[model samples]
Target: MNPTASSGRSPWPYPGPRPGDDDPAGGGQTIADVGEFELIDLVTKGLTENDQVELGPGDDAAIVRTRDGRTLCSVDILIEGVHFRRDWSSAMDIGRKAVAVNVSDIEAMGARPIGIVMGFSAPGDLSLTWVRYFIQGVREECDRAGVSLIGGDITKARDITISVTILGDVGPEGPVLRSGARPGDLVALKGRVGWAAAGLAALSRGFRTPKAVVEAQQVPQPPYGAGLEAARAGATAMIDVSDGLLGDLGHIAQRSHVTIDVHRSALGMPEPIRAVGQATGIDPYVYLLTGGEDHALAATFPPGALPEGWTVIGTVGESSTPGSWAVTVDGRPWEGRQGYDHFH
Candidate 1:
């Protein structure tokens, strides 16, 4: 399925002359020319509120109500050359990705997202139309996740940077923490794991043929509903697969003071990822074990407590030594890099 089409909304819904068109007033204006308040107006125009929103944008602060008396919050930032490249993705894709990653954090905690506030900074030379398409992407993703775009700030900077903070409610069951896994828990996962990493490899080498994997990297489809379902089904611990599966699971192991062993036979590699591996001369398991940005959910549940849509991929065991390696594949330590490291 087309990830962009999942929202059932046009990727570019703005009705106007295309970017760089011959329009004298709006079409060719840059961020500097449009100014800050006008850009805010362009972004907030037509934004709708949900039942949780008490006060939407235009005020000093936006208000959101929490039904559970507890709010779950997560923040993530995407930088221009680091997290994305303009030549590689459309403005809409970047916008969707920015929201998707942040919200995945909310879901990992077994919470329902209520709203998002964004902080956008871009070079003054950036085109106004690009900003419009970016916000359109954000709106599409917000609709897909059933969250409100309450408010955000825009400013001038040297590079385009988007910072998003998502708020969610976990209800009476409370938030699921990474530290709850027990020795006998079954490790399960929902959503695709390695596709985005394969997509990144392909894009890095100037190949984009495998449309599925490529699009996965551009806009991840984070099985948003599965998190809540897993929580309801008695998940002991959970996390979103933003980092590689092993790396994120390592967090659970460290926090819960257990060791997790992933079964290689259980992790089936998709055709697109295998194809990418074959073309790039990289092992498919590398992507499966250490790939990041897929936003898949991984959790530990009691035996026979597996929920629908989740596949058992590993088992949790007691750690023999304190402060030791927390994750293993096929009962041994992984040989190379565990996952993405920002400063590595």
Candidate 2:
């Protein structure tokens, strides 16, 4: 029998409205009313255990079954005001975005994500209905990625803060590193790049008619299985494109001791992105080059080894001189900002 049930507490701590319930405004019971323990019960209840989870929540720690002896781990933190705005995104969107961004890091290493543990802190006045929907989003993303929600911790804070740590395995091929790109490798991309940035621009101007771009900003759609496929196809190096394309590629260039040059022609501007750029009087290339949070996969592959769904965008070359630019567009240095800066 479950210890929680034996203690005479209701199995479902949150007996209030669920995701699609009429309480879309989330006006009912607040976190302060439910308290901490019961809130934990609400978050952990009915989590689906996968084959990789040897032990899940209720234990001091989770035991995850890794195929290879090695494990890959990555963490990402999202603060309310800094990383998200409640008015712009729902609790569910925020939850899904948190999981997607973290999982992309694992995939970037050419590994399979197995499980995740989250640390969530929110103000006491936050509604329990919001919490329920947020957990639902987390669970939905975990299911989509075929990973398990093993465990997590919750606490009270002035603002909502989400910290997620994802665990992955690289199998026998071993994890791909950012330092593996060679001078002769081909640079490729395997996901959307500028859609989120365009979406953000739309929302900032108080117009959300373009539903596609708007939704892209709220919940990123990362190419999940492409990382392992690229690894299997003999990718030299890879990275998750969370902080713009050129900026992220710069990391690979610096670590791999190679210079990367992106061809502008290869990155054809999508119609929607162009429309956003036109309306805002901003160059579309700016979004593709310096916008962040797309969570796309960028990698280098040997000649003729490119996998399906990956578009070759650039070429790796020897660094010409010390302190030379790591990444360039159409053989020239990018004029303005490189990517997002937390402080700037």
Candidate 3:
């Protein structure tokens, strides 16, 4: 739910064929039209080779080079009906979101993405148009991050499922681990929070969701390189707000053995989100504190060292009570439900 506006165009070097490129009859093609291997070839047509990726798709495994001796890696899986719904999002939007969520982990670690490997599974009857557009969306977001979609596996499944693994280079400064936060460190945020949660609420209630808010839920645009920027500025600790703000910060606090107090007034909820709250009778603060899937960067830094897009919303402090919640708002513990847990 980062408030940042999307570029609104595919950033991929090769966007593949236009809609009319296939099936001059205008009905468009289905994945069933081409076998699995053929579909792979079509989707990977313009992936191209890059120097960082010594070996790319079509191989049993991909080879990537890291400038530093160390490499950072993160993986995530999005399952149909669980992570997203086809009716609510286009294939392209789902694809972009998959890439964004994985890439956000890399960025949160203060690393730059170098390569990605994906595993795609779907029913044989799925539309080829859907698959094609999905691949295009993935490629677009990867290209925007200057990362390569190196290689992956494809298969048949009861429903669409995308598994992605991203590799990143942390450079010499090393990754900004979540365990580094300290008392007096400033708590900062660099992307949206409540927008997606609010949008989801609107959709569930059958309310008229604003265009931007709906887009935020369907295709989150995480502040792509903000993690690296925070690292460069000497961030003490950091996390991607995939879960709700306080929930994720609780992670940082527990790991770093410190307390984090967020200032409610500093959140600056956008007008659209407020409108959504008004319509739903849901407090905007609930979205800000308990909503998830924003993928915004939240980190602790020296008070004056925060980077450009960052807004200081809190401060790290010492734990007064050992077993107490690690994160608070306006010096009090957040009273809302924590956040999403797949099995809970």
Q: Per-prediction TM-score, please?
A: 0.92, 0.92, 0.90
| Worst-scoring 10-residue span by lDDT in model 2 | 1-10
Per-residue CA lDDT of model 3 for 1-344, tens digit only, reads 23322345334222433222342232665666788889779767878655778888887888888886688889999999998887667767788889999999999998888888899998887777678778888988888878898888889899899999999889976599999998999999999998888878876665435756777888898999899999999999999999899889989999988999999999988888898888878888898887888799999998889889899999999887764437789988777687888888
Model 3 stretches with alpha carbons more than 4 Å out? 1-28, 321-325
After best superposition, candidate 3 residue 89: deviation in angstroms?
0.8
lDDT tens digits by residue: candidate 1, 7-110: 35443333433322334344687888979999899889999988998988999999888985788888999999999987667778889999999889988998
Task: For each candidate in the order shown, give its overall lDDT on alpha carbons.
Answer: 0.87, 0.86, 0.83
Deviation in Å, model 1, residue 299 alpha carbon:
0.4
Task: Report the C-alpha lDDT of model 2 over 19-118, residue by residue, as the tens digit.
Answer: 2344555667799998999988988888888898899888788878889678888999999988888767777888889999989999999999999999
Record all residue pairs in model 3 with backbone atoms less than 3 Å apart, i.e. clashing.
1-192, 2-192, 30-128, 31-128
- Superposed by TM-score, candidate 1 places the C-alpha of residue 19 at a distance from the truth, in angstroms, of 12
